[model samples]
Target: MNIALVTGSGGLIGSEAVSFFADKFDLIIGIDNNMRQYFFGPEASTQWNQDRLASDFATYEHHTADIREVSQLEPIFQKYGTDIKLVLHTAAQPSHDWAAREPFTDFGVNAVGTLNMLEMTRLHAPQAVFVFTSTNKVYGDNPNFLPLIETETRWEIDTNHPYYKNGIDEYMSLDHTKHSVFGASKVAADIMVQEYGRYFGMNTGVFRGGCLTGPNHSGAQLHGFLSYLMKCAITGTQYTIFGYKGKQVRDNIHSWDLVNMFWHFYQNPRPGEVYNAGGGRYANCSMLEAMALCEEISGNKMNYQYSETNRSGDHIWYISDLSRFKEHYPTWDWTYDLRSTMTQIHDSMIERLAVTQ
Candidate 1:
């Protein structure tokens, strides 16, 4: 049995990833400093995931150390050494608006933190498979690239796109020239992840993901995406919808779906591969469309208001052209539909609130 390490184990993605890999791997190493507090204030979800893991998972090492601090991270990697088979680097300060305000901490956590992970991988687990969770934001404000049309529910690139090809491909320009502080940071890390594979010949892969959503989320109003939307609907919290007449689109993939794919890549390591991990055009939805679905599930209309101005670096119609990832891992596909996903997020938020209240 191979040992695996996951950074940011308290995050929405990291939380689900830890539970998913707990029994599967011989030993699991979960490191989290709860540094997401820098952006989301005291309302971060780090402790929730940590508590869940403490109950269910055994044969795991839980470290509360910041990845940005190299001294804190290197020891764990060194101890594991060749025993560690895979390293899933998911820890980062991921917030567009927050990144804009505090670009220093954002760069330090994402760009510098990633650099430290690479260094650790090179020093200790030289042959280990490195899987970096990237964002579609690396492509930046891609709404300008397409001829977007707004519908009652959602936005589409065209009336009839081939393969429902309403979204940007990996080949679309990453040279985004507007509101791109967050984009620039992630891009730096994304390229470095690939570079390590190419220049250093490390077994690394990059997943430029779109709207990764699921149940085990902290569900912050500003960032948690679908979970936050569900929280807004269920908790009757005021929610803000920015721009595109609330018809901006995103392909929402469940956390389990993405984590499963990450596992598959770990089992069958490929050299320096970059794949867009998302639900594709068919599963895509707009802000209003998803809110409607949430309302349908929760039996309440969303307490939401739309702002005329768009958020910085927000995509108008961005779904993944997942053909490349599909071709590589033919069996890798998402099972959850938009309706089901919204419902799941609603239920999860409800459950979380029951305990908190």
Candidate 2:
């Protein structure tokens, strides 16, 4: 039986993976403990998404297991063994701000949790295609050092820079900058994932994502940039923009689009290959630009405040260069652009809010 195992199975990306691969894989095994709630409070809890998955897909077997606990993960891997064909490790302490509050917890989840998964995969389903959802933070503040031009509403790379047309690529250095507590832990996990694949000759692909967003995301103040911003717009909650004069930019990729990249990679396995994945130029926006789009879509003038201080290790401007991933999987391309994606988030939030109300 072809089984797919998804860690953080209730998250924006993990749940998307389950839904996307439900028809393709025989059984979908999920491990998520709703750690997001702990990381960003009750509003960020993914339990609702978990419940939705259970209701939607019978083939999806849910486990409220913490990836940080090796004992909790071992039995699941052992039970399925080689039958598990795809291991999607998406669980992590996602916010750098929160990471500073507890460095041990952050390292335990992001770095140690990844090590556990890799070791388990190595011992059990050595042949399974392991896909890790790494972060752009791995590049640290290195991207900030680039020659960036500030526009009226957004920050853009210099037109003459090689990264202007496409965006930042994997070749960007991952060193000598403030990575924050969260980025440091992710870098540890990121490099380890690569090492496992290269050293073990296991098929592992690392995708460094920008802002991964969707309706399913349990948007919070600390993370889930677009989702939270949209939520605030719909609910009349005041949103805060930090530093770079709210011109900080990020590429936002829909969850389905990213999971599709995982599907393409799983179809044709590559060992230790890393790809920068995001909306690219096709679906990117600055903070101010995104706020405007949210207001446009929700028809609500968002209550927002700007802060002079920026989040530590935050990118002033970043858009993933899809050239490498596209070159590798020419068959795959982005289906959701920025406007459409935000519209989906707006509509979905409205439906969900109505239900709750």
Candidate 3:
């Protein structure tokens, strides 16, 4: 029974990864303060998730503490994580739209919070395989570089580029005007995670992910892209469709696949590697495409209207060039496609929302 610790265990990604590893690990420890709600306020959905996990995962124990406080974190690391074998760090302030309100808060958590985790791991779980979830926003607004053709449903790169055959790759530049405060913090963290592995010889790995959505997500207008859309469509919540023609693109990956990468790398333990984790460009879709699926499934037209004000650090298109991960993790692939995926999330949101709140 390997002991596993996840920092942002209450979040959409963290909860999914926790569910995936619960049966396998001896005892899984989840650390989160649910403080994001303070930022997102009433719109934040994590409280429902925390309540559900407390009920469902009996073997899991959660601690309500901010990672920024070393005193709050050190004891936990000293206990279950003293020699913890795997650390899957899914914690971060992920809203590009919301980051501007407090750049320092975002930096404190995404950047300094990560440094705290790494330093603590160095002290207690030095040999532990550490996995960090980074965002595709690290590449900034890349799809802006491409010539996009808009369809009624979605947007795609021009047919001329050979690599557009797949989508954006790891080679795309991180330096661009599109990066918001969230992107800047994440970029800083992503570089440090890699640097810690290189400089300190830690078993560190980074995942620059596209949209990672699932049923556990506390979907809100600020984050949780797919689940938020599903909630709005099924539950009659209003949503905003920002610029880029609502044709801005994204490739949604299930949380299970993202965790599988961590699970595999944890067991085998990679030394400081970065991979783009997503459903690949093959599963790519635009906001219109996603809402169309939601509308089709729930039989409700989304109560969404387009806005000319493009959100900062928002990408017009940024699909994962997931070939790197696919070639390495041959045993792993997408278990859920767009339609069924949306359906499962919608049904779960209905069931869980009814039961929890």
RMSD of each: 1.5, 0.7, 1.6
Model 3, span 1-357: residue lDDT tens:
478888889888889877998898887788989876876776674766777778998878888889878899899888865558788888899898778988889999999999999999988888888899998888877657778777677777778975577777787888755788999899999999998899999999999999998777776788888988998897788889988878888888888878888887776666878888887765778888888889998899889888899887687877788787777777877788777778889899788668747
Each model's TM-score, in the order given? 0.96, 0.99, 0.95
In the range 119-167, model 1's lDDT, one tens digit per residue, is: 8998899899999999988877754567767677877777575535435
TM-score (C-alpha, index-matched) for candidate 1: 0.96
Candidate 1: list runs displaced more than 4 Å.
160-163
- State the RMSD for candidate 2: 0.7
Each candidate: what lDDT? 0.83, 0.94, 0.83
Give the distance in Å from residue 167's predicted Cα in candidate 2 to where it truly belongs: 0.7
Tell me the spans in candidate 2 whose CA falls farther than 4 Å from its real position.
none
Instruction: Please give, for residues 1-357, the per-residue lDDT of candidate 2 as tens digits.
Output: 999999999999999999999999999999999989988888888888999999999999999898888899999999999999999999999998999999999999999999999999999999999999999999999999999987899989999999999999999998888999999999999999999989999999999999999879999999999999999999999999989999999999999999999999999988999999999999999999999999999999999898999999999989999998899899999999999899999999999899989
**Candidate 3 global CA lDDT score:** 0.83
Q: Model 3 misses residue 140 by how many Å?
A: 1.1
Q: What is the Cα root-mean-square deviation between model 3 and the actual structure? A: 1.6
Highest lDDT: give the candidate number: 2
